[model samples]
Target: MNALPRRRPNPLSCLAGSLLLTAMVSSAAQAAPSQQLIDAAKQEGMLTTIALPHSWCGYGEVIAGFEKKYGIKVNELNPNAGSGDELQAIKANKGNTGPQAPDVIDVGLSFGPVAKQDGLLQPYKVSTWDSIPDDAKDAEGYWYGDYYGVLAMGVNRDIYPESPQSFADLNASEYTNGVALAGDPRTGNSVMMTVYAAGIANGGKAGADALNAGIAYFKQLKDKGILVPVNGTAQNIAQGTTPIYFDWDYNLLAMRDKLDGNPPIDVVVPSDAVVAGVYVQGISAYAPHPNAAKLWMEYLYSDEGQLGWLKGYCHPIRFNDMVERDVVPQALLDRLPPAENYRKAIFPTLKAQSEAKTAVADNWAREMGVQ
Candidate 1:
């Protein structure tokens, strides 16, 4: 979310504004799916999807759940690929009816409009379309946000008694040679967002200027030997090699529980700046199984599907709506980090994120004078 203003209306506040809207839309949205659509989807039998990592967003179970519900097979492709690769897949397989072609894509929000402009995407609004915030989706249903996550500090509590509450805390001499990114900023969304979030904390805004300032800040960390070059991982954090890692809140919290006290880590959404990053979903214009792709969209925006993402710690686009309606289970809400942190989170526009991504890629290493 290197959220420009960060998309937030606490669960309670959302009700005051959304309750009327929700009531107006509920009747139409609750209508059952026409048998014709289901029949067509069944006839297609398969839906090819791309760039969905099982561990990243509880996708392993999501896929299994979808398959179980529909008897349709989901053929996953290049689970580790990026948003750019997802677009390339659509371009390269335009006329191909093979399994290699993706029926649907879940990519960075920025790529949605570009894909639409490129004529690579098809439009299909889900049953719960109104629940998706207008700003997070296109007017024509070309693409819509599925879920979002905020970046946070993952501190190995075994090494440090307290977590760093803000970016400035990283400068503490005790944190020397301890900080690292979840992955390389030049190549990864989460990594680039970490830089963007740091820049905001350092007083830069949500666009390119903030990105350049972020790059400069990282250079300072490097010069002081405070920010190490290695990519952060659960195993390395457990090993205490990357004691202070900047990464998504969901990952750090998940890893903390998985580690089970061997190395307790504090996943702190820094007090100074909170950035929300959202990923969007779209169907391929040339999809071999158009009905199936549309069916997948319907399922994803449904309560079951949204909950699947929420289970994985992601904030589903319909989360506040569900919260207002009391549909989210208390146990699930209990598992997440504080809601107050998300209140202050900024959700940067796709333009801001695109500019930030480019700035980080073009200047991160060059500005630091690193080869």
Candidate 2:
């Protein structure tokens, strides 16, 4: 599968390398974009933008499609710049430039609030806004998650003939020191979601007692010298330098295709528990073309827009619509955890997420020197 275009790159190159996930098709009950939003976006003529962090390679297809459909022009910026830098670039260029700033911003869930608080983000809910679940979007319409990734442990069968089923299994001496840590949670957005996943596996807020279990899980792997740190690809795992990895389900699944043999890789959303971590997108408060930015969001969440995500392997946020249309492969659908299980998947409310942010950072610093 092709890589989706990344919005911006961060300095934490190492941690950014390992996380992955795929598309989601939201419900038709969810709001669909209005013809007006679509028409206005086209009139804007050009859509200039930036997407934070980077991931698979198919995003260009989405951008290209939107431009093709609307006859609007889109210029996606580089993927190597961090969100901080990308935001600064827009702030720095305020009012003077013709391009102004990006029409949209895609980022990790945690950072969405941070950007909102920083007064960096603008709010505009697409006409089809009602379709988004409350938890998936801001009430004020500042941002909404287009898709998400569930945390899953991936084993490089080449390195470990035996696959790991749970975090407890991962901590076992047999697999100890063989797993690769995704890198510092502080610098990488996806890994931050991993930390939150660890929280869910340990037991949400009630899992405070088990938080140590989560910490010890990583500690054991680290102390065993079995845990290897890698970014997005499975190069280390495939080469047998690292036998196990924990990453976004979509990422691990996608990476397996790059290997030569079956490679004995298994990625499972821990039945032990899971978290609904998200990658979000929203219109820039100062978008060069606000209408186009709103249109982009509408397109992304629409049936056509979400299909690209499924084709690319990111689990679509809205599955009911996609499955009916057969946008995703039945074979792929079979690989996913049950939909009801998704409801069981923990997604921290914004307040809960804010708390996790500091706690995750502080704990990582104290426990793994990650911050």
Candidate 3:
């Protein structure tokens, strides 16, 4: 019978096998598009950032490094604007395709969900998404914390001779007309947290309903003539105009170099209460250069980015992660206060923060007699 023809594998089976293999290859290829994203971002060639001060959180170096690495130009707007100003810029420039419209924003932590609710932000998780703490990020990736700092007392040593180490010390006759806040409590997150910290020192808990103690504490400072009405600035601190500032630790730490230590600025995390506040990053809903914004996000969360913030004395959100990985530099680590100081650091819950903001805004001016 002509030597029975060798049985042939089914042609249909071979075709189906080829198709499945092709699909698998395509799926693997689509797994990550980081390189594709870089190419697209390069094509965009420009990024717009709002309210990012080069000196704040090492943004100056971060922006320079990004520009050098990608050859994309960054247009920084309103370097001195506050978190509220950043949000306002996005809303004001909505639907515009110009440089005035911000591509990314770094705002007070409480503003993250607010932006998300207002549809001002877009969801985009970075390659290191899993590395971020779940509680520090939005479920849909609308925003994630970049860095944080503790509210501390920054005293001009030349003016005070001896620095106050506790919130209660500000009420002493020695600090009369010396105490000032970073900004108005009614609108500034730093100022609000300062009050919150004071309240904690006065036996108040960290909750919306528990801010009365903080309010009373500030009222006492005002009554004693220790609370200055002017906002504390580096210039004011250097000139001894606002010799004792209740501000962020990073800001005070930066003043040491900014003022050349003429009088020397002493930063103290109060023994009674250590309150920490976070700053969050988000991509604009109407980013003119979307890919570049995404790339910026990736850079900010990367090891290089986190270390950059650390260099500026701001604790990166991934600070603990860096510690575990042994990636932080020894010098930078040494600059921070002892671990014990942060052991009692208390971060407000989102609900608590919103409540606290409202409480401050509604009662600050009325209670303290300053707008």
Candidate 4:
């Protein structure tokens, strides 16, 4: 369906690709949260979350629903903080039992293991833990995948009437001084993954090889003056400065709705290379409200919580389970970008992401002139 009026392209095409799920097996009825857990959380009184901007993954409504249901205050800190910042906050406030310390964190998949290994996380398996994909969670329950977003581009139609079809299309001079990433490629997982996708599109293998290829592609863009050093944000998109901004599909979808087609925005998951990024959720080791933190996890892993994320265009860790049970709302399913685009999308292994992180952090500045 058309995204808006007469000429506007759908922000997302109806997805047609199979979700690479190994746990599409059927399951019994869901186990609702235990009353004991809910009571304990209420006694603790508050849950502090970090790096959860409402627009990121339908978090605004989810948080509100939790607070309303349990009457537990959710003290949000640094709405714009990145995964690194969340980890830093946890370390810095290990001794302080105050609002500054985060009780829960939603971070890149790679950060989950790091945080657990660093003694910054505590394990508490949700009741529906069995439904969560094995690859998306820690066996010991220290961390778990909350939701995932596919790498996609947000194109401003005001500047270029036609949308770029693939990563290679961005190399055209027409996008000169316009190509950007929502995050800094040198340190941001999303941006790094974008590079990975581009690299794969340019004929690099997945993981380290793709990252190298991506770097080479960027170099080409840099030589052509088609790449911009600026971090693309919603404001920048509206301003028409960064006309072609590569970012998570959820983020771009939110921007599309927010913009309401003012200048028009197209969220396209490039056909050449499709990559999905999963963000994990963990309870901070130093959480002052441990019970509250546990309760928060229970709420999130529950169908209600997973559906909350789906409403925001995020594919929850329990997506396969939900779909198998025929629980996902058809309306939401219809809005997803066509699955054919995601046919080749690969969820990079932790090893791949780690290697990419190292490669980009070490070489971005020296080779591309910016970190």
Listed in order, each prediction's TM-score against the native is 0.87, 0.75, 0.88, 0.91
In angstroms, give how far residue 338 of model 4 lies from its true place.
Answer: 2.2
- Candidate ranking (TM-score, best to worst): 4, 3, 1, 2
Candidate 4, 48-96: lDDT as tens digits: 9988988888899999989998999999998887778889999999999
lDDT of 3 by residue, 1-371 (tens): 01112242221111212110010111111123389898999999999998777767778998998898789999999887777788889999998999899999998888899999999999998876655556677979999988888788888899988888898777789888898888766556777778888888898876555566799998998888988888888888888899988778887877776777787888899888877888899999989999999998888887788888988889886665566656778899887777666666677777777888888878877887765
**Where is model 3 more than 4 Å wrong at Cα?**
1-33
* Model 4, C-alpha of 131: deviation from truth (Å): 0.4
For candidate 2, the per-residue lDDT at 89 reads 57
lDDT of 2 by residue, 170-210 (tens): 65667655766565555555566665566556554522333
Off by over 4 Å in 1: 1-25, 28-32, 369-371
TM-score of 2: 0.75
Residue 133, model 4: lDDT of 64
What is the number of backbone collisions in each predicted candidate, taken in the order shown? 10, 40, 0, 8
Instruction: State the weakest 10-residue window (summed lDDT) of model 4.
Output: 1-10
Note the Cα lDDT for every prediction shown: 0.81, 0.61, 0.78, 0.82
Best by lDDT: 4
Q: Which regions in candidate 2 have their CA more than 4 angstroms from the true location?
A: 1-60, 71-73, 78-101, 203-216, 258-264, 321-344
